[model samples]
Target: MPGRDPADRSRRRFARRQWARRWLAWRYLVAVVALVAVVGGGLWLVYFSSWLSVAGVEVEGVGLLSATQVRQAAAVPQGEPLARVDLDRVRARVEALAAVRSADVSRKWPDQVLVEVEERVAVAVVEIGGRLQGMDADGVVFRDYAQAPPELPRVETGATTGSEALREAALVVSALPADLRARVDHVEASTIDEISLQLHDGRTVEWGSAEDSELKARVVADLLAARKAQHYDVSVPGQPTTSG
Candidate 1:
């Protein structure tokens, strides 16, 4: 081996260099092929594959509304790509139902559309056309009750009372503490500024505007607990008075 020619050694070294260059080129080619395969597979899975298509709709957070009702309202097309479903459009449709205050629509990956809804809760009932309508805390009248539920307070509005007055009455009722609110028989709103609460015991509370309602609620509760009265005047909560 020590007697090898220099030209032979040079030729062997050159052959090794050529082989290494070929291996480096093959590595780049394999990497490029792998990258292309990954990109193509991702595109097919998201846009052209049926494996991730919508198969059904799911509903949540519904009490007054049935899951079937919410699904129908959502109107999510069966077999459409789940990633392609328009969530905003679905949400708007679900919210169109009177009982649904708001809704959130989303894709439950792989095959379902999810609809979560917030239903309106009644804080009081109002008589409109001899039918009792449930009113939420925001004073939006919705849902007709066949018979008034005993737990919720009623709101009595004069023929001249407008929606604003009814809103004020709702605010006054909502401000009262639960224990105190339970004692109220009904609320009367002659005008936005003229709100009153009538108790079941033939007693009345002159509640003024919706302003200072929290203070007024506290004052009325304290006055009732401290003394027996036929009439309570907490219109000016800072200086409350009562009379029998």
Candidate 2:
């Protein structure tokens, strides 16, 4: 075997040391990445853990529903992490409550839960069992009339409570002009084919059926505009017009 030069030997040792250093650096980098991943995952798991009790609850967009009612509706356990709450179930439960038109439930990170609700808007007063009750657009009768709103129209009919007649009456009331709307004393829908309006001004508007109420309203408005009329017959929209 040939003897190696001193300079060449030194150079070879230097290269081997450099290679070892590079290898150690790569290993250190890999270890650091793995350690960081483990720590990050642990932190995330701890933050989102369902077993953690909910620490906070925020209720928003509630009008008819009280904060206590909203909490009861959401049914989220206090001190439990938001991740543990069933958002869909909570929303469904809240919406099922009377006057709750809509609801949304969400998590607010770590330990907070949020709930939002929309309350129904009462449109008219409906007569049920000879008792006047407040009814919303969705045909939900939510309140018994101790005192009339005086602003909303009244619905009177022989039709059974919770019938389509009530719904039709609600639609008609919702379509009337704000000024004229308040003057409507009551809407009668004894027959599905016929609906009538009794104005507070002691005028009668024969608004047969809830169909084409906008057109009927326009025609009636025109008639009322043309002259001072005590009664209007809009049973036939464009065919024959009669007024008194």
Candidate 3:
């Protein structure tokens, strides 16, 4: 065939350019639609879908408390959106149990609420109303003991002893080293500032206040290792004294 006319070729080229422009416009619209669809789908799955809702609760770090008890305390809403669950509220509820010292609540994806609890550990035992109560290092009287354990030292509070005194006594007991603690028979607190420890070997340590407890413990340990005495006064750790 003879060479095509230049005008005819030019018109075809113009038409192709218009078509390319229109395709570009449609491509932008398609991309926007796809983005909206993805965002909407993600929102639905996270906020309203049953597939990601809570199906069960898992408990951990429970010793004194049963899993059932922790679950009941948590009260995590079943069938609720896991992403929408209030973890802080769940944690607060679980920690409200007297035996639970702290708790962590989290979502296990695809349908589980995870609750981890740190339970109170007894550092000493005290008698109240003819019943023995377990006291933690923080001086919290948490659990009642049916019978006091032989390894745990007892705290003896006199009529003048108040809550502060009990706390001071607890601090004193908690500050003792393991070997010293094992040797402790009982602690007596007449007031917040007057706390003493009686050892199994019939030796007494007069420890004053919860302040400077670490220093007092060190002094007591040193005195016991260097001397034999029925009485030790580390109330002033800087000037410790011992006498028979």
Best by TM-score: 3
Please estimate how well model 2 matches the true structure, expressed as its whole-model Cα lDDT: 0.78
Q: What lDDT would each prediction earn against the true structure?
A: 0.91, 0.78, 0.92
**lDDT, candidate 3, at 145:** 90
Q: Across residues 80-150, which tens digit of lDDT does each residue of candidate 2 receive?
A: 55565678888898888887888888887657778888888889987677788888876677767777788
In model 2, the clashing pairs are 53-79, 53-80, 53-81, 54-79, 54-80
lDDT of 1 by residue, 57-100 (tens): 98989989899999988899888878888999999999999888
Q: In candidate 3, what residue range of length 10 has the lowest lDDT sum?
A: 1-10
- Give the residue spans of candidate 3 off by over 4 A: 1-9, 225-228
Q: TM-score order of candidates, best first?
A: 3, 1, 2
TM values, all candidates: 0.86, 0.78, 0.90
lDDT (10s digit) by residue, model 3, range 68-178: 999998998899999999999999999899899999999899899999899999999999889999998888888999999998999998999888888888888888888
